[model samples]
Target: MKLLLRLATSLLLWIIMMVILVLIILLPRDMEVKRIGVKDHMSYHFTWSGYKENIQQYLADVKENKTLGTSVAHQPVEWELAHYGKRSIAILVPALIISFLIGILKGVFDYRRNRGLWKVLGEGTTWLGQSIPDFFIIIILELIISLTIHRMFPHLQLYGIEHWYNIFLPILFLSMYPAAVIANYTTQALKEEDDQDYIRTARAKGLPETIILWKHVLRNCWSKILIHFMPIILTLLSSMVIVEYMTLYRGMGTRLMEAIKIKDTIASTDTILPIETPTVIGFSLEFMIILLLAQWVNQVIKHFLIPVRKDEHT
Candidate 1:
């Protein structure tokens, strides 16, 4: 019931945000372009009729499968949605899975080893990874791969998602920061769990360190780990814009940029009204759903991990 309420609230919030975004986009802007035999002409107005007309036209285009007639491209909004939706999923799913696994494994290793070169390298790498901006990482990695590896293997293109291998670099770029964040939190959570009385009791019982850490400590630390997951997801979502743009992946982020650039133009001049509304709404929905899912997952994990106490009845 609570989850349902939360979901409803999130959906409502997303709708509100989308409405505001659309209004901002639809609001007229003062044009400063020089017209022959005319002084500066500033025209800016907000009208309900315009907003309604725009919405109706967008819906009509979608229903009739009509091309949006964008200044740069003549493609139906449906095609754009389907194409970018698939690419976004392709990038998001694999990057998330790989990052989560790497983070958990790195966290476990960091907790187990007291002193070693592996620890030194892992700590240094994660710290560096967390500190650097994702775009810089993407640029540096692209340069290194293009110069050295691509010379030996010309099949791998530096930009554009032409093949399956093309996604590798972008995914790596997206995953690095989140993975490092997760690993850092995981290590801290486990270290804190290590000093708890339950851990001490397990150690005193002569249980193997591996079993105790994995079966007991790690199980207890899941709730704590999940608490930090939402921020990691938000980070990944934001980073996708840069990564997709840099790699020319033709995803939602790229579409969003195009939409923003042409938001103020007239439909006759640039017919992106249909494309802009759906793109903005689609991205907003995706973001809200992911956020809600993260919250739900965290709540489920926390509920399961928490101890349920029985009340004594006289």
Candidate 2:
């Protein structure tokens, strides 16, 4: 019931945020006109009706099996969607999997072993990973890999989806921050759990350290680690913009740049472009959906944690 309420509240907030963003994007702009007598006349006006009309038209186009709209490059929205979906899946899935595994392992290790060179190395690596900007990492990796590896295999593509290997750099760059954050949070949560009476009792029973660490400490800390890592979705999204743009991956971020360029061009020319509305709204919807999904995942993990923690106490 609590999970349901939280989900409901999150959905409501997401909707409200979307509505606000749409309103801001649809706000009026100043325009200049020339008349017979007046050399130059300036007017500022809202085009609510036009915005509504464009949305209706776009929906009708979809029903009739037409394009969503044209992008700045004159490509249909359908094309952009296909490419964006592909890149998003390719980058996000592998990154998430790798980050979660690495984080969990490092965290568990850090929790069980207090004094070691490995612990110091792990801590230092995560701190450095969290501190460095993703874009800089992407660039450095590209340069080093291209110079060394590309020379041996000139056929490998760095930026496009022509081959599966193209995604490696972006995924590696995107996963670093989240993995570091997860490891840090997991270690902290486990450290806090270390002083609890239950942990003390578990220790008193002379259980194997490995078993106690995994079955007791980690089980309790998992949900909190997930909660702390939820915001990594936003980080991934932001990183995608730079990663995709720099790599020319033709993903949603690249499409967004195209849309932004189109909007800017139209504004400068005093031309009201209907295509910009759908383009902007489409990206906004994608972001909101991702955020809601992250929240739902967090809530689900939290709900499961309640039962597990209760069992531990019992």
Evaluated at residue 56, the lDDT of candidate 2 is 66
Q: Candidate 1: where is the Cα deviation over 4 Å?
A: 30-32, 35-72, 114-119, 262-314
The residue pairs found clashing in candidate 1 are none
Candidate 2 lDDT over residue span 1-314, tens digit each: 88889999989998999877766665544464434474444455667786676456656866786655666667776666666867776888788878888887877766666667876777777777779887777778889988988898897677776776778877877787778877788788888786788778888999987788888778887777777656777777878778777776777777767765633333343544434655766676776788788888877877877677667656
Give the lDDT of residue 59 in candidate 1. Answer: 57
lDDT of 1: 0.70
lDDT of 1 by residue, 1-314 (tens): 76567667766776687567655554434233333464443344556787677677765765675543233355555566667778887888888888888898888877776477877877777778789887888888888888898899787675787777777777888888888888888888888765777777889999999898888888777777777666777888888889899888878778777765544544342233333445555555555666667766665654555442111110
What is the alpha-carbon lDDT of model 2 when measured against the actual structure? 0.73
As a TM-score, model 2 comes out at 0.81
Q: State residue 155's C-alpha deviation in candidate 2, in Å.
A: 2.4
Error of 1 at 190 (Å): 0.8
Give candidate 2 regions above 4 Å deviation.
30-79, 112-116, 262-275
TM-score of each: 0.79, 0.81
Specify the highest-TM-score model's number.
Answer: 2
